[model samples]
Target chain A: MHGQPRPYWNPLVAGLILGLALLATFLVTGHGLGASGLSARLTAALGSWILPEATAANAYLGGYVKAGAPLAGWITWEVLGVVLGGLIGSLTSRRFRPKVEGGPRLTPARRLTYAFVGGALVGFGARLARGCTSGLGLSGSATLAVAGFVFLIAFFAAGFLTMRLARGAWT
Target chain B: MSFPFYDSGFWPALALGVLFGLALEGAGFASARKLTAQFTLRDFSVFKVMFTAVIVAATGLWLAEELGLMAPRSVFIPTLYAWAIAVGGALIGAGFAIGGYCPGTSAVGLASGRWDALVFIVGMIAGAAVFAWGFDAISPLYWAAPGPKGQTLDQLLGLPVPAILVAMIAVAAGGFWLGSRLERRFGGPIGSSDVTCGSEGAQPPETGTRPGSMRPS
Candidate 1:
């Protein structure tokens, strides 16, 4: 049972905290945030377990396979912390309700389908770029990496253009 | 000037990860609606937070190096892979438009107990598997268009760090100004479903409680 939920923090305020968090990560870990790498590692590990011969021969998955344990990297541990933090934030703020979130117009099945399809595209793209929004989009751009800016523009442009598709069924 | 403390181990990683998560959840990113609102022009929180965070981080990073408090190149710098990221980021964007959740946000959404977020994660894993399967074909493009390692925008443009950063700030300010106008025009904050729920994990569903100012009827 969820109680009254608090409003979200103002964007700038939250952004400050986020920036500090990222800065703290750099000062402490010599790197920035990441998310998609975990998926890659997981997939590679699963492949290694399920089809060792074939997976190990894979050009990308093999690199991960040879890279030792999937969870050995620092990003994995950080991402675990992120998951825990999310739960803690939700519980404390009374925002922790277990439900499939979709707008009124969307059916649960359709939302879930959208989620899966979208997630797949994001996963593939993030891996191709060697990072996702948090990884390359935020961290890289902050460091002024040229690819980061390039990624930023490309990502947002594509998103705005295709957003109508997402809401098409809703209308 | 590497910081020896960073070598201490996973404790920092774990602790920092928690902080990152708290910031994201606290920012109201745990909900898919909040994320997608920016795309719809109903809410600009994503753009606001993104620009501010990146600017602050870039400034902080530069200051730390300037003050010699942080090690030179202590943080990981993203490499330049022009085509790979160009193509890949577009895909990610398209996915975001459709899914309304990125990899990190999906994690937060999952923590909030959304089944869709879980499905998203599963899809992500499957998608990664697809990339792994086709790595041979993709590897050529992925490896192509390599730029110098650790190339900064300042270096690329032959400008000082401060100049580039300041210019970015100006650009962001302009974008922010424009974004506010867009929000005003759209008339929205398109509240998510069950933004205000009763005592139940699964609240009764409906069209969002607060529709945007000009949502297509």
Candidate 2:
């Protein structure tokens, strides 16, 4: 139901555009971009709804709940926009074919499993670091924050090492 | 209007998020294989895009502050937790290598109809829940070391802001130059063929198909 996929924009060009967006965000909002916070907030909110006692008693989830309504928070709205933007881009570019994407070495199930585990690790890691790529890697580092650079270096080094070990997953 | 307009300016934040997502998808980051290619040194889009964005945004922020266009301390600086952040970052990196999509790109991939990305998002939520439950164990280290919120790189390195900026710019430019060279030598060819999302026989693009490279040619 789609035509051939379009070629992606050049990396530098895309980066420049993205950088402008980040700058605009900083100029207007006085905060850098973020993504993983959404997951933490949602988890906190949903957990409290399902197990108010347990969630509130839990140190991490409890703090998130006290912060504000999860759905109405700043990053929540931003992430909603992220989904919408990607949807629009995919639709216009004709790249919206729904399927399990993976390297030649894996089956759909395997790919999905790896994706889930990887996502889980990132989720926990982001929470621990108090931010993710957009927050710590880009925004934090952009501000020249010490923590931001630490995260960037640590994550890249760990990622390369893990990728080497899991060569079978993609190679 | 005012700086740090989170309460009064959610609309703007949402708009910026869209632009961010669009840029990532346009860069082919909606594709997991395309993203993971960075680890293999087969593609450098991730490095190129990230550093470019950093350099541009950081420089712009510095200039704006200097010009008094934006109020100082308007931007929220993350607090420093040395041990927790380092360990957390390592975990995140391992996750990135395995998952291919980070939180933002996973959302983009899901938007583009990738079920794997959806699963990954779900996994993230579950992981967060686990972290919550395990907070007691991690809390000690999480709170072990803390720095003032405005712990910028210049302060950390004992270098002035301008010097750090200059260093960052040079490093990013050099990385881009090096990345292209690596891609030329070790990278898998970017595909011009029709991308198939088929089952069993389908392969993600730009993954090595050679003895150890990208997709089937």
Listed for each candidate, the true contacts retained, as a fraction, are 0.77, 0.82
Please provide, for model 1 over B3-120, each residue's C-alpha lDDT reduced to its tens digit, 9 standing for 90 to 100: 4256537788888889888888888888876688788876788888888888988899999888888866767898888899999999999998888789999998888777878998
Q: Candidate 1 falls in which docking quality class?
A: medium
- Assess every candidate by TM-score: 0.93, 0.93
Candidate 1 docking DockQ: 0.69
Question: Model 1 over residues A1-171: C-alpha lDDT tens digits?
Answer: 446687788778988999888877777777788899899888988888999999888878887778778657877888899999999998888888777766556777888898899999999999998899999999998889998899999999999888867776333
Off by over 4 Å in 1: A169-171, B1-4, B190-212
Provide the lDDT at B37 for model 2: 72
Residue A103 accuracy (lDDT) in model 1: 59
In candidate 2 the C-alpha lDDT for residue A7 amounts to 78
lDDT at position A66, candidate 1: 83
Here, model 2's chain A TM-score works out at: 0.95
TM-score of chain A of 1: 0.95
- Runs with alpha carbons beyond 4 Å of true place in candidate 2: B1-8, B189-202, B205-217
